[model samples]
Target: MTASRSSTRSPSVKVAEVSPSAASCLNVLILPLAIFNWYGGTWIRNELEVVVVVVVVVVVVVVVVVVVVVIIIVVMMIITIIIKNHNYAFIINRVPLYSA
Candidate 1:
């Protein structure tokens, strides 16, 4: 069984619905656009690769450093509160009872 697909596609083609010739013209133009994109992309990729990599590495390092600093600050804050509470408790317990 030989199945030949329809040259004209479904009604889902919006450009063809607007103008019949426009869709065919658009199809013809795709090859040049694709070629330009391929070459342009390679040029951009080569020039930007180092900058992109450096920016990504710097961002990652900054995030890690910030997270570590935040964690250290939180731990120190918790320790400080615990120590203050302990000292307060000890001082309170040591006070002598006064007669009214």
Candidate 2:
């Protein structure tokens, strides 16, 4: 027995053809997505770096404020001591008056 082969071939289907306007729109939409995909890791790293810089700035500001307050307190204490010593010296140097 001989096997018979079919002579009819299948027709090739064509995919959808895009218009020029639609192709331009696609390019516009895809450009940002492509850029993001390429630089996504760098974007995340840049955000982290910004956060670190802000934290460092806050810490430095706090340290500077604390140092300024300490200096002010030390200066006030020194002034109080000097004033007390001046009053004591003036009182001690006063002459006693005898009745005429």
Candidate 3:
């Protein structure tokens, strides 16, 4: 198998590829979104918006998954307990005694 160029790129080479002004922000993928608008302002705005949207989506998905898992576990446990105790009764039958 051939080695990938980008994955094999050195740290210094990757650093040199990006401009000094674009070094920060940690939003390298945002550059393509603002390709039409080369000005830094539009890029920064679009980048922030995309990051926020992605983060919110991820958080919502995680919460939904956790809730679903908890519900499933609780349901399973309840079913197991009911089946195990199905033969048992909560009330005992007793005959009334006559008064003297």
Number of the top lDDT candidate: 2
Highest-scoring model, TM-score: 3
**How badly does each model clash, as a count of residue pairs?**
0, 0, 0
The pairs that clash in candidate 1 are none
Q: Provide the overall lDDT of each model, using Cα atoms, as 2-decimal numbers.
A: 0.66, 0.69, 0.66
Q: Name model 2 segments beyond 4 Å from true.
A: 1-45, 88-100
lDDT of 1: 0.66
Ranking by TM-score: 3, 2, 1
Decoy 1 TM-score against native? 0.43
In candidate 2, where is summed lDDT lowest over 10 consecutive residues?
1-10
Which of the two, 2 or 3, has more TM-score?
3
Sorting all predicted structures by lDDT, with the top scorer first, yields 2, 1, 3
| Consecutive 10-residue window with the lowest summed lDDT within model 1 | 41-50
- Model 1 residue 98 distance off true place after TM-score fit, in angstroms: 29
Residues 4-87, model 2: lDDT tens digits = 324544457465698999778756755554577687634435545545655676699899999999999999999999987776
Please give the TM-score that candidate 3 achieves against the real structure: 0.44
